[model samples]
Target chain A: MNKQPEKYQVFEKENEILRHSKDVLASPELLSAQAWQQEYERLAQSYAQLLGEVKLLTSVSDRLQNKLNKANENIARKNEELTQTLEMLTRERIGKRATTIVLILAAFFFIVSELVIDPQLQQSAKIFGASGLIVLKVTVAIALKPIEMILENLLLKTAVRKKMS
Target chain B: MENFFLEETSKTPKLSFDVSTGKFLMSGRSIPENSIEFYKPLFEWLDEYVKKPCPKTTFDIKLEYFNTSSSKCLVEIFRRLEKIKDAEIVINWFYEEDDEDMQESGEDFRELIDIPIVMHMIAN
Candidate 1:
């Protein structure tokens, strides 16, 4: 009386057939030729049925696995697309912040040049003149581009670090 | 016979076998931890149903997913239905349009079972 495996425990009909086969095997010479032929045919039919079941089950299982694999691939692709969109949004936000910071800095510099630097340049009108004031304002205007670039890079780095943490 | 209805859960499918209508439905996921235990009542109901089956026995199987054990239980269910000598039995197997795997599974069961299993696609 061989114990059925845990997975095959539910297959009571198949197990019964197996037990009958074992009984037949135990007394091989007792049965006549005609009886033996009948047993052989019965066993053959059972085997065919079991084979059909096995084939169907295997095919279904494989198909389900494939479906799960495809679903996983889709999720992975969607996750990647989401991450790219998020990064783009972060860059756009940082770009706007950088531009605003640069604008404010430019306003502060303009105010200082008018209130503080213009008076200081007045005393040195002999050597510097009004061209000195023009040069100062032009330098400040040219520096805004690099200032904005620096601020954007700094903000981007901070954002990246925050995300990593 | 009383109608047998089991609500669908995370691990098991909904089973609705109306004695009056003879329109049985087994839908949703079927990945129960104990497949045999989960399907025992259905099998018993089917056995009784076969003794005095309805004129038109329509079984609608709209499962999205089922494990191997559930599939075996399904085979048992089909075998029980085969015992009905008089009833006009039809199994309507439904699957999503993009779910070729599920469609192929329906075809596989159609080949194995003696009863007519009509495959229907649910538009994605």
Candidate 2:
């Protein structure tokens, strides 16, 4: 039954005014053109931000494409170099294989001729004279030794050169 | 002068120089193990030919590829041709249209040599 406080009354009146102001602000008739202008400005700023993002994405895409092209060119050049190198290596390997086969055949013939044919020839030459037989053997040994040494030296030189290269 | 003819190997080009026809052709790949041995006699022959230079000398170069050594030999051949006096030298450099490297190589040779070089781009 006591009288309400003055502070409470004043607070109630302030709340009522705030509520009325909010309603007025919400009303279309109370809204000024400046408010719409501000809203439009905000929307324009957001659009500008989105446009900037799109521009950045485009630039990034262009850079990526350029990098991809460079990578492709590098890969192609590497492939070409590899192919040429492989071809050269194969040619050299085949040449070496052929040379090895020839050398093996030559050695096989040399051994057969020296061990079997030369001894038989020397025995047949004994029918002529011991001097002739000894001379034939000496001649064959001298020729074969020099030839063998020469071949060995050539092979050694070739091997050394190959290793150095 | 005797004609120069060398059979082509897997890694070397065919070289045929006809003295009567004045036609010289070098075709195929060139990556010889001994470039000096392969090219020494060729240069000597060209040197001798320059003494009795023909009225028209046509060189047909249709190389698919070459290494650095072979490139040096090619330069030597071009220089030999450049030394000829009172002789018309015609060099036909043939390459595939899509071979950018060969095109650039032709351009490089053209810049290095002072001779009439015709670059022909053929489709492979």
Candidate 3:
């Protein structure tokens, strides 16, 4: 890893201390115990500063890890939900199928009654009058969607019975 | 039976299931009030197609949104395709970048179906 700028500053300070070694060791009288104690204190302070920076970086790293964990957890939860939803959908076609069967069958029944069954009945009742055709048309119109829905329910019941067997 | 093709609408997806090249595709929104009714023709066509399938059938699916009812129909479509024994059924599910829901939906579908499904991410 690349050296941090603060670490580089510490290295420069150490190099400066090495350069002044002659002064430091030359005369104990000029550079006495008091001066030596001051040099020791400066090095100690630098070490403490470096320790603080390390602690800060480690804390930031920990926070990022926590965020990553939370994101992963959210994704896992969503996946579970999706699985459950898919299973439900895969099993739900019967209900929709019943509705579709009704719609198409209803349309078919309507057309047959109007064009086939009703006309035949109308022809048989021609002696009564053309009013029979009008009545048949009215009844077919009133029962169109409802009768289809009823037939659809019947079909659904039969399907359920078959499946149970 | 002739190949099926239904144009996309605001409430439904575009459906084009051809037989010549064996390319089945459905794209866009699918929120029809009666999804089963809308998909009835597709099922009828597939029933015929599976009888004499092509070497490789690629089903491309790209849906921006779909309702719960449509989900069931889609499942039915996949189940129908699963009956084919010869043709290689490949499903390609496409989604825009950062669309996690769509991607996961595709994942869910692939898990339930026997066919191979590949997910593709496009630019958002």
Best candidate per lDDT, number?
Answer: 1
**lDDT, model 3, position B48:** 91
Worst 10 residues of 3 chain B by lDDT: B67-76
DockQ of each: 0.65, 0.01, 0.01
- Residues B7-48, candidate 2, lDDT per residue (tens digit)? 988999999998878899999988787665688889889999
- List, residue by residue over A27-120, the lDDT tens digit for candidate 1: 9999999999999999999999899999999998887788789889999999999999999999999999999999998898889978998777
> lDDT per residue, candidate 3, B27-80, as tens digits?
999878776677877877888989999898999999877765566567668868
Top model number, TM-score = 1
Instruction: Please write out the lDDT profile of model 2 over residues A24-54, one tens digit for every residue.
Output: 5578575689976775575566556345434
Candidate 3 has an lDDT of: 0.73
In candidate 2, which residue pairs get closer than 3 Å at backbone N, Cα or C atoms, i.e. clash? none
Clashes of each: 0, 0, 0
Where does candidate 2 stray beyond 4 Å?
A: A1-165
True contacts kept of each: 0.53, 0.00, 0.00
Compare candidates 1 and 3 on DockQ and give the better one.
1
The parts of candidate 3 lying over 4 Å away from their true place are: A1-165
lDDT of each: 0.91, 0.72, 0.73
Q: Give the C-alpha lDDT of model 1.
A: 0.91
Top candidate when judged by DockQ against the true structure: 1
